[model samples]
Target: MIDDSIRPQLGIIGGLGPLASADFYFKLTRITQAFRDNEHVPAVILSVPQLPDRTEAILAGHDGPLAPLKAAVSTLNALGVACVAMPCNTAHHWYDQLAANSRAEIIHIGDAVVAETRRSLERGRVAVLATQGTLVSGFYQDRMSAAGFELCLPANTEFQACVDSAISLVKAGSIVDAAVETERALDIAQATGADAALLGCTELSVVAASLNDVNGLLVIDSNAALARACLTRLGFGTQEARGLPTVSRPPGHDWPMRGSLAVLA
Candidate 1:
C-alpha cells in the first residue's frame, strides 16, 4: 500500500511484455517510503499482458500489437493520471501515436535515458542493449544522435535472440534466465565498443541489476530515472518533505524488479 501524502496519480500502460510492467511498478515502490498508509505515492497500473508481440508486429508490419497498445493508453488517460510511463522501452517507438491518442503525457524512456547518459559521460559511444523492435524503430539512435552521442547496438541475430529470450523468461517469471541473457548481451555490447549499456528493455533491468553489472560499464535504469522524475513532479522534493521517508532498496531484489544474480553468478 502507498501513502496518500503524495498527489498526482501515476498511470502505467504496460504488459507490452508483462515483465517490463512489473519492473516499473516494483521500482516505483522502492523509490518512496511509506511511514503511514498514505505517505506513498498513488498509482494505477493497467497491466494488459495479452498484447501481441510488439517487436514482431513492428518488424512484420502487423496491426495486432498496435491496437491493444492504443487501447491501453486510452484507458489510462481516461483514468485521469497525471502522467503516464510505459515501462517497455521498445514501445516508445510509437511515441507520437500514443501521445496523440492519450491525454496523459508520455514520459519517454529513451529521451530520459539519453539526457542522463549525456550528463554521465562527457564524450563516448553508448550502446543500447534493447529488443530488435526498439532498434528498428531507431528511438535510441535518433534521440541520442540528436543529443550528440553515438549509439551502438548488437548484431541483428544476437539482438533478436537476446530480446526474445529475455521476454520469454520474464513473462514466465524466471528471473535467473533473464539475468543470464543480460550478461551475454552486455558481453556483446563490450565487444561492440560500448562504454555503457542502456537497460533499454525494462525486463533486462531485472537481469542487469541497476545497470552496474556490466563490469565497469555505466548502466542507465530507465525505470529508476522515471521514479525520480515522478517524485520531483509530486512535490516531495520540497524542503518540507526533505526528511520524509524515502523509498530505497538494494538493486535487483525488489519485486517487479527481481531476478538478482546468485552468489555463484
Candidate 2:
C-alpha cells in the first residue's frame, strides 16, 4: 500500500535541450503557491544533454537516442516518484515506449497542450510553432485534428526556416533574435487566420511569454501547460497557475545538467 504521509514527487526527464528544461523548472516553481519551501511539490530532475539528438534520431528511425531517456525514467521510478514529465515536445514521439519502460506514470506534454487548447478555444484555427522534426512526426497534427481543432502551420519553406532559426537562436542564447523570428512566425499565423497559436517547441516556450499579442490571438505556452498539469496531478490547484514570470535567460548549471542526474527530495 502507498504511504499516505509521503507526498508524491514529480520526476522530470529533461536535457533534450538544457535551457528549455531549466525554463520549465523555473515555471514550475513560480506557478505553485507556497509560503514555505516544503509546501512546494518535490521534483526529481534528470538532465542528460549527452543523449543523442531527438530530431536526428527520429529522422534516422534509430532507437539509440531513446536508451538514455528510458534509463532516466527507470532511475526516477527507482527513486519512487509517482509521475514523470518530459519537457521536450519532440521526445513525446517515443512517449509510449518510455512509459512502457518505466513503473511511474509519464505525463504527456503534447496531450496537456491539446487539452488546454480545446478547453480554451471552442473551435478555431490553431497555429503550431514547432521544430522541423516535430512537424514531420505529426505528433501535434494527429492529436489536434482528432480534438476537432483546425491546425495551421508555416505556409512555406521560408516560414518553416524562420521557425527553425528562432529555435536555434534560443538554444544559442540569442533570445532577442529568437523572439524576433518567433514573432514573425506568429504574424504569419495571424495572417493565415489563426485564432490562437501554440508554442509547440520547448525552446519556443522559453521565449513565448515575452511575445506580444498577434492580431489579438491567444498564444499558448506548452511549458506552462505542462507545469500546471504537474501541479494538478500532484493535487495542487491551477487557478494561480495562469501566468508565468519572465525568464530573461536560461537557468545556470546549479541544477543537474549534461551527464549527471540529481533527485530533489
Q: TM-scores of all models? A: 0.79, 0.87
Error of 1 at 89 (Å): 1.5
Instruction: Report the lDDT of model 1 for residue 225.
Output: 62
Evaluated with TM-score, which candidate comes out highest?
2
Candidate topping lDDT: 2
Relative to the true structure, how large is the alpha-carbon lDDT of every model? Answer: 0.68, 0.79
Which tens-of-lDDT digit does each residue in 20-96 have in candidate 1? 66666666666665556566667778887777777787789666667778887777767667788888877777788
lDDT of 2 at 198: 91
TM-score of 1: 0.79
Can you give the lDDT of residue 245 in candidate 2?
53
